[model samples]
Target: MPEHGHKTPHLQEHLLNIPVPDYAPELRQLVFDYTLQLADTSLILGHRLSEWCGHGPILEQDLAMANIALDLIGETRSLYQYAATLEGKGRTEDDLAYLRSAVEYKNPLLVEQPNGDFGDTVMRQFLFDGFHYFLLKALKHSSDQGLSAIAAKSFKEASYHIKWSSEWVIRLGDGTEESKHRMEKAVGNLWMYSGELFMMTDTEKQLLEAGILPDYTSIKQQWDEHVAKVFSEATLEVPQQVYMQQGGKMGKHSEHLGYILTELQYLQRTYPGLEW
Candidate 1:
């Protein structure tokens, strides 16, 4: 939060600190789309965790969720700032974040899904963090220097995030009867959305061709191995057969996103150009 009546430093000044290298003009749109995808996922999931700020099961866990939310929102700001630079449209990161229609956001379906109970939220975060931890590691090797830099910085936070969430998943899932029941319900609620993370669009395909990203197969392998190990410890059953939802990466989203944006964009939409 900003102090009343004191001007905060401009966001663009911070963005200037990021070192983006020269790239072919053909790569501009590709990078913009890819960066937006990453930013949107982080932003939506950050917002979801923020809903837990004062509502966690305990005080320490409350602070933990807040810190993780801040970590994700921090990553989102860098990615959105980078995407705005790529667009060359005079759009600021605020504009990209606040003014876009829900249809324009490229976050995966898994991220934008609502955070349910504490157990549900933990499951959601663990599943997404599992994928995110590996994806950032892969992105650190990108041909695009800017993406690589952002991924490297974000990967540090992600490592802790996964550890935190997975520990909770195990603690709850392997706990007493009621706790284990909630964890099982959470797995059923969120597992279907997990598969969409691996589904690729043309933007991902183009980036893969240019070595800006690794195959989703590889990331999925790492995610599956880690998830399986944790689940075994937790005594939770992995879903056997499931139909996966798709299309959020390419702007087709669940019904939930429209409602999320209504609240998320309300402050900016009501008071355009106002910032703390």
Candidate 2:
């Protein structure tokens, strides 16, 4: 296993050894975009979870949320590092993370949505975790070895996240009348955003063709099964099919993302290269 902190030499070596075909430039660009999508989701969702740093409903839950946020931010750093290298633009991971405009981010809108209540946060995490679990599982076999390495490392964390969030979903949904009501509301409100997870953008399509990205169709079916099983156990109803939300992957986002960026980018933008 790669060490938690510091650069992973093996990952760098794997990236360097990636067999480039004739259209290397185009391939690199597509991979860079795909990587940014990964990084942006983790980065944005990490920030959202960090908002609960000292505000979790209980002490243990507080610590768990914070630790999960740290894990997500760590994953974001690894992804952004690879993405920067792929871009060949002399940009650091910090540059790609903290310096981007709201419109430049490629995260799904589901991640950027505000953490509402504990029920809301857990439902959001559960939905994303379900999809992320399968996505990372598939990416572990990617032809791009660097991505495979990152996916392999991140898969462990995603597994824990899925387990934790799914348990919370069942707990809250089956707990009390109020808790069940809140969980149901959270599910309904967030269902529209979930569809965007399976919608392939052009970048993903290109990477899929090149064997650099996984086929999301099968992943979506797996996500549905996992979600249905959990919801059934919780005695909660999955929201009815509706027109699903879109566009966050294409740089179009809800108004909420702007507020997130304002806080996230403020110190970096104001200080112009400040470091901790």
- Whose lDDT is greatest here? 1
TM-score of each: 0.93, 0.92
| Local accuracy of candidate 2 as per-residue lDDT tens digits, 1-276 | 657787745533323333333347878888888889999999899999999999999999999999889888878888888888777779988899889998899999999999999999999999999999999999999988768878898899999999999999999999999999999999888989999999999999988988888889999999999999999999999888678999999999999999999999899999999977
Worst 10 residues of 1 by lDDT: 11-20
Clashing pairs in 2: none
Q: Across residues 1-276, which tens digit of lDDT does each residue of candidate 1 receive?
A: 888998986655446355555768778888899999999999999998998989888999999999999899989999999988888789988999999998899999998888889999999999999999999998998878788888999999999999999999999989999999999999999999999998888989988998888999999999999999999989999898899888899899999999889999999999988878
Top candidate, metric TM-score: 1
Candidate 2 Cα deviation (angstroms), residue 143: 0.5
The whole-model lDDT of each prediction reads: 0.90, 0.89
* Stretches > 4 Å off in candidate 2: 1-23
